[model samples]
Target: MKWMEFSVHTAQEAVEPISNILHESGASGVVIEDSNDLVREWNGAEDEIFELSQEDYPDDGVLVKAYFPLNSFLKETVEEVKQSINDLLQHNIDVGRNEVTLTEVHEEDWAQAWKKYYKPVKVSNFITIAPSWENYQAAADDELVIELDPGMAFGTGTHPSTVLCLQLLEKLIKGGEYVIDVGTGSGILAIAAAKLGAKKVEALDVDETAVESARSNSSYNHTEAAVTVRQNNLLENTKMKADVIAANILADIILRMVDEAYERLNTNGCFITSGIIASKKDEVKKALLQSGFAIVEEQMIDDWVALVAQKK
Candidate 1:
């Protein structure tokens, strides 16, 4: 089969949202090429061994590429993707050049292109995320390895937003706590919670594809019995009150669901939210506070922020 390779030149800040756009548009996977990865200093020779080819990357800014199956609607899909990305400008998001290009490639070529971008990444003290194809061993006895195929889902479990969520989960989740992971892309957080000893975890996502991916991932991690993946909107008529509720989603969505999150938690329950840009930190915090949640901890990585709130 043939594939249409869609490439966009966007700013670092726009990568997450743009990649999300592609995924929603039916792209099978995304490949991020950031020039910073080439020039940034690394602590050891591990990164140096990758041997990046300068010709494949832009001189500045970041390149995000994704693959869509060549179909009758390919042209229309591309146009829709471009329009959605252009819409980002209205949100005050810097889209950089925002130049989009398309090329035809065979399935084999598209498959090989994404592999170079994915590797084993240690996102937190206890969690190491690796692609299903990589051969990675835990460096420590306490390390938890999550193997993900990623596919078209939004969460890789290694993004700063996700890493922050995982780290907070590691610190906050004691044995037998009940967890509800909203927007549970790839089911990483729910799986992590289960692996960290959560007695029961419900992983919820509005997207059926994401819900399916999360279920498969949970099964792969041997947490299927502990983590349940379901299709549900954010805290909509949630029947179960959990000890912890995690939502790694946009700040606006988080704001909209803050009250519901509070209502769905048991007394003194923890609400963890990430996928917030630093610019919107104060706005999210205010909403959480107004919803009667006390901000207990805040974490920032790069330009993203995560907040841990407790119901009093």
Candidate 2:
């Protein structure tokens, strides 16, 4: 079988969303090449060493690649992917060059193409995300591990947005709290919440593939007993009140759902949001405040920002 290798040149802030668009378009997996990663410093003897070549990365911004079967619907799928990516501009997301290119390759080539780009990453002080194929061991007694097979889904739990969410979840989740993870791609946050001692977790995503992926991941993490994965729009018709709610989606979607999140959280509950570009931080802050949330903590990493607000 043949496969289409699609590549996009986009800004760092646009990486997560664009990868998500690719996944929703039926890409089997994704590979990200960022110039910054080439120069990043690593600590600890267990950290994996990468041999990166300059030729593979852009001098600025990021390159995201995905693979899809070369089926009859390939052209239509590509057009839809491009249209969805272009739609990001309407929400004020910086898509950078937004240059997309495609190449054809054999199925064997696509199978191992993305593996080199993925490795176990320590996302937070206590959490590490490792691909299923990697051999990783916890360096600390307190560390927790999340085993995931990304398989075209969005959450690797290592992106700045996701790491910020995990850090806050570590701090905010008191034992026995109920948590809701909106747009739970890969079910990372929901599983983390469950492992962190949340009594119950409700994970929701609009994409059926994401929903299925989340369920599988929850089970893999042994969190299925505590986490429920469902296909539902963001917080729509969600009747269960939660002690903490996490949404690592775009700023616009987060803005639109602030009121619903505020309503669904219990008194003094925490609402953690990420996948917001730095420039839109204030805009999201304003929306949260207007919806009766008190901004408690703000975290910024590179060009992304994550805000933690409380229902007062």
Candidate 3:
């Protein structure tokens, strides 16, 4: 089928409005580039390698992407989508601005094309992400494995947040301990916890796509533990707790839920956190201390830190 390419140079400020318009208009997807031209996905794939990886865009500081397969309305009203985006950008009196471009694709198969870019990755010494399309060899006597494909959610263990969480989980989680992974992206952490010998594990993400990804990954591992996957927004039910909890979410969320996490842990239970920039480490530390969590261990890599703290 033919697809139309919608390109826009949108600042972070105008990205949301343009995204809302596209969503309301039933557009297939919209991709946004930040002020630095970094990649951000509003309604489509989350692969941002082009921004961070040099191989994809060797021409430094140039960020450009094409979104295709416009919905019926968007295809018919292509000019309308362009106008909405252009209007939103024009409304913002920012000095440096982005422009929008439109083009048509005679024929394309996005679903089949994206697979060529997806590859197997290893997050830890003990865990490897084998996409369903590739062959993964396990070391002799290896006890655990995790299998996944980049279907529709993040967390193939390639993201910094997921890797840091797994690193912290390996240390904080002992054999046969109960673990909770809030906002479990691809169930990567939950699968790792189960492999690390957690007697019971629970993984929940507010995003339904994430929940599905986690479930599929868990099943691929053939995990025996009760790795319950649910669609919950944090631990609203105060009656629950865990021996270990790993939340690799935004810094704002980590600070906001510090108290609830403290209240939701057994004495000596460790809480591991990641997805924090180095600049926000102090904020998290202060929140943890104020919430009665004693620092246990901390590690940082590539401008990201993961902290393991025990209940005081």
Candidate 4:
């Protein structure tokens, strides 16, 4: 089979949103090449350390790449992706150069290109994300490993927004609590909640591919019994109540569902939100507050911010 590599040259702030745009366009996988990775500090895990060539990255900005099966609709999909990314600017997101290019590649080459960049890394004190192909052992007795084949979706759980969500889940989940993961790409957070002893977890995604990927990842982690993946658009008209509701999506989407999130959560329940750029941090916080949530904690990594808010 043939694949079309859709690559974008943009600022670091645009990577997450553009990657999401590509994934929602039905791309089989996404790859991010950020120049900052060269000098970026890792958490110092032995397995996380690897040689990164300076040549594979852009000189000034980040390159976001995604693979789509070569088909007649490929051109149309690319246009839609470009438009969706351009829409990010309305939200005040910096898209940088926003240069896009497409290249043809064999299935084998595209598959091999992205795999070498993924490896096992602990995202939180208790949870670690390992690629499905890697044989990673827990360094501690309390470690919880989430094995994911991220080719199906845009999440590897290594992005700072995701890492922040994982860390908050580790600290908040006290076992046997019901959790709802909105926009559950790759089902990473739902899987982590289950591994952390959530009695039941419902992982929701609007994209069928993401729902399938989340299900696959949950099964791989043996959390399928506790984690359920379904196609839903951000808690719309859902009667399910959860002890905790987690969303690691763009801040705009987060705001759209804030009221529903608060309503669907049980009394004194927690709402964990990530994928918020620092510039939009105050806007999101104000919305959560107006929705009757008291901001309890905030965590930041680089230009991204995550907040933990609670119902009174």
> Clash totals for all models, in order?
0, 0, 0, 0
Model 1 C-alpha lDDT versus the unseen true structure: 0.86
Model 2 worst lDDT run, 10 consecutive residues: 41-50
Give candidate 2 misplaced runs (Cα > 4 Å). Answer: 40-56
Best by lDDT: 4
Clashing pairs in 4: none
User: Over 4 Å off in model 4, which ranges?
Assistant: none
lDDT of 1 by residue, 209-260 (tens): 9999999989988999899899998888679889999999888789889989
| TM values, all candidates | 0.92, 0.93, 0.72, 0.94
Residue 66 in candidate 2, Cα distance off native in Å:
2.1
Local distance difference test scores for all models = 0.86, 0.87, 0.65, 0.88
> Candidate 2: deviation at residue 188, Å?
0.7
lDDT of 2 at 262: 94
Give the lDDT ranking, best first.
4, 2, 1, 3
Residues 239-263, candidate 4: write the lDDT tens digits: 7789999999988899899999999
The deviation in Å at residue 217 for candidate 3 is: 2.0
